[model samples]
Target: MTTMQLEIQAIAAVVAAACALPGVFLVLRRTAMLSDAISHTVLLGIVLAYFWVQDLASPALILGAAATGLLTVWLVELLVGTRLVKEDAAIGLVFPVLFSVAVILISRYARGVHLDVDAVLLGELAFAPFERLTLLGLDLPTALWVMGGILLLNLVVIGLFFKELKLATFDAGLAAALGFAPALVHYGLMALVSVTAVGAFDAVGSILVVALMITPAATAYLLTDDLRAMLGWSVGIGVASAISGYWLARALDGNIAGAMASMTGIFFVVGLLFAPERGLVAVAQRRMRQRWEFAQTLLAVHLLQHEGLPENRVESRVDHLVEHIRWQPVYAEQVIRYAERKGVVRRREGRLYLTDDGRRLAEQMVARA
Candidate 1:
């Protein structure tokens, strides 16, 4: 691979890892939509800051964007807390309006400027590697330094307050009762998300930020129950998506960030179908096994019930299984075969009878009931 390709992948990996870290907590807290809100509304902050400072390179832009992100969160929370609007409704009301204003302002006033909606929304990762930053005596891609710093910030925040974040995410009420200040932890997490989004969006775009922030974490959530494992899984998934996505984009001659975002969806679909305990296929298998076990138990109980009664003796016969137990013929045959395999039933003279172990189980079932 060329040096440029490696640089692009490195930047994508850093951006994905940074976004995915806070994303774990966001997914756990069921606040994933907040990333989308912050990503869009932060544009208005940037535009307003640009107008104030009249300089695109000033740090004020990031500060303004971060403030706008926090404002979006505060507004949604305020509206939700008042019980006047639901959380989703509050998000729906806030982000679109802010984003539209930012778009209109850009169109009306900054038409000749470097800022464009495409860069803000979709990004141009292909060009990111060309923007070099000179640190001391070494030259590095600007995205590397920017995304790397944000990645470090996110790591430090998570490392320092892992316990508090965990408690606040899983059980806010319990955390509050225990003097953890869930509200503070929540805002702190939002702040980290805001900062990460701003730093990464310039390279990967806001859409990619939202996708990376939520998708990998959500996929990981499906795969693990332990919080630390979930976080580790999410980071791994994010890095894989970034590297794979770069290759996908190269193969298709398409957008790198979009390719990586697509990979996140692919990974999530795999998890949805194949995760050990929580996946759709696994859950279906468990339920089917449970149904079969219950059917076998009922079959054993019915055979034991008719064992010595003359009038009900025919009920223990294979031919009477369907009519006596109100089972379909095919179902009755299946249960009989299964029971025989389990050594729970024996067939002789075309009649079925429970074995010694089966009789004991039937007795125990009756006793328990």
Candidate 2:
């Protein structure tokens, strides 16, 4: 509606898209929690860099944060390599120490500066528009420029190294064998993630950075199996979340970053419940169909087995099938009805008989078994 509102939403959207790009690989690689780890530990890098430069606007801060992110990954991998602790445990052990050190340094030395814990965890997007940058003779929010550049960087890197990243992610051993240098690609990805996290940190904060980095990618994973499609879906969902979250925050008069994160969760829940092949509802329906089909198969097989036997008369009786097949009367009746509709069985004189198709079906199932 207004210029400031548009600027803020644009910044949020760019940040969301930037974070979502590397998130796809993170989700697939099962290293999603690393985003959370990097988001927090990068604060220490910022503090140390700031102490060196005595300037908050220095690019050294971004470089320092990226290095810290790589360090976090290296430490976690080192711990995991020992086979003593698992990956999750390693991350839990490493990030807190680094983040805590950052907190301590901020409280002790940078107390008079704007580097506070609240801003790092809960950034104010509404204020983002005030930090303007003049780029190519156009004035715009600094967050927009920063996140947009990061988004472009992500696109170029992913495009150029898509195959390498994919192979390394799905099968690192094969990738290395094929001379892809999976370890190098892995650290390269981590470096990109680090830069993206720090770029978004000023606009969305650390918590929302993790959310945008993981949630959209995870939600897209439920909706599709193709990696390229997943990346597109993730970016789309992230952008939608950013725009919708702005409106939600406006409606509730709430925090924009938190609202955006909440929207990502909402999208994920929707995908989890209703995705075509992998959703809960679809899975339940598939199971229910299988149950009915299985019951029908059993009924057909039972009728075929006793077709001409002396016990056929009693065993084929509709009422007697409950005891013969150990089915409840109600369940037996339902199975019989379903089989009849499928032209697999016929009923006459209270007896059940398999039709031509049902006999063929039973014979095949028996042969397979």
Candidate 3:
């Protein structure tokens, strides 16, 4: 891979892992949208960090940004729990105001600042590699180490506290009664979310980072009930989508961030349309096929039982043929036609006989089902 592709993939990997960690719990907690709020409001921390330390690489900036992320969570909680504001409403009222202030600060005070609002909102994955920031002479974007450390730390912490998080998320009252510090866990979660958002910002920008954090986990949730499987599958899908989307963007000469988000969406779309039980097309086709096969099975059973039934009698008398199965004649005929195409049944010499492949397939289906 080119350095640019490697850098983008590395950055995406970090962001994907970090997002997947809290995302599993976030979805379970019904706080999936909170990540969206944190992504937008981190600008306040970023702008303040820039102003206070005047150095982008300062630890103070990262801490400041994380602090602001936590503050945003606290503010939302205060609005929702204390003042009865719906969370979506509170989020709508809060982050935009904070973001507007950050924009104003950058525009007025840090006039000639390279911190563009466009980058703050949309982000630039393309330029993330050229920054070439490193620690101890290892050539890599600083974003990688920052997000990687956060990902590793969160993975360990969450793994240690996995049962606690499940209890706290599913039944906070029970968790509290069991001596789990639900409050402390909640606070820790929001803090980690803040840190994650801030760290991923430089590489993925804000929205794409948010997209990476939520979409894959959410998609996995639709396909799996186990938390561990969900997290693993989510990370797998995310990494695949990241790599695929990077190449797609390179192919089309398109925006990398947009391409990545599009790729994530594509995965979700595939999950929704092709998944075994829940996918739309899969469900429809399954029903269609089940009805078709049931009709074929019943027809075979009836013909086998009534070996002397004429083909004309069988074909023209689909209604009688399907009455036991209650199949619509049109549907029955169509299914029969489909079966015929499969070489399962032949209508010749005014009689029907099952082909060898058809009988074997039918026997296998009956045995399997």
Could you list the CA RMSD of all candidates, in the order they appear? 1.9, 1.7, 5.4
- State, as a TM-score between 0 and 1, how close model 3 is to the true structure: 0.78
- Output the lDDT of residue 75, model 2: 96
lDDT score of residue 15 within candidate 1: 91
User: To one decimal, what is the Cα RMSD in angstroms of model 1 from the true structure?
Assistant: 1.9
Task: Give the alpha carbon lDDT tens digit for every residue of 199-270 in model 2.
Answer: 999888998899999999999999999999999999999999999999999999999999999999999999
Q: Which segments of candidate 3 are over 4 A away from where they belong?
A: 133-137, 285-369
- lDDT scores of the candidates, listed in order: 0.90, 0.94, 0.79
**TM-score on alpha carbons, each prediction:** 0.94, 0.95, 0.78
lDDT per residue as tens, model 3, 19-116 = 77787777788887788888888889988988888986788877988888888888888898876778899988888888889888888988776788
TM-score winner between candidates 2 and 3 = 2
lDDT of 1 by residue, 1-369 (tens): 889988999999999999999999999898999999999999998999999999987779888999899999999989899999999999999899889999999999988898898898998889998899999787889889888988999999899999899989888899999999998998899989888888877888898899899999999999999999998999999999999999999999999989999999999999999999999999999999888889889988988787788955668778887777789999988988888898999988888889998899898998999
Candidate 1, number of clashes: 0
TM-score between model 1 and native = 0.94
Candidate 2 stretches with Cα past 4 Å from truth are 82-84, 308-311
Candidate 2, residue 68: how far the Cα is off, in Å = 1.0
Task: Find the 10 residues in a row with the least total lDDT in model 3.
Answer: 309-318
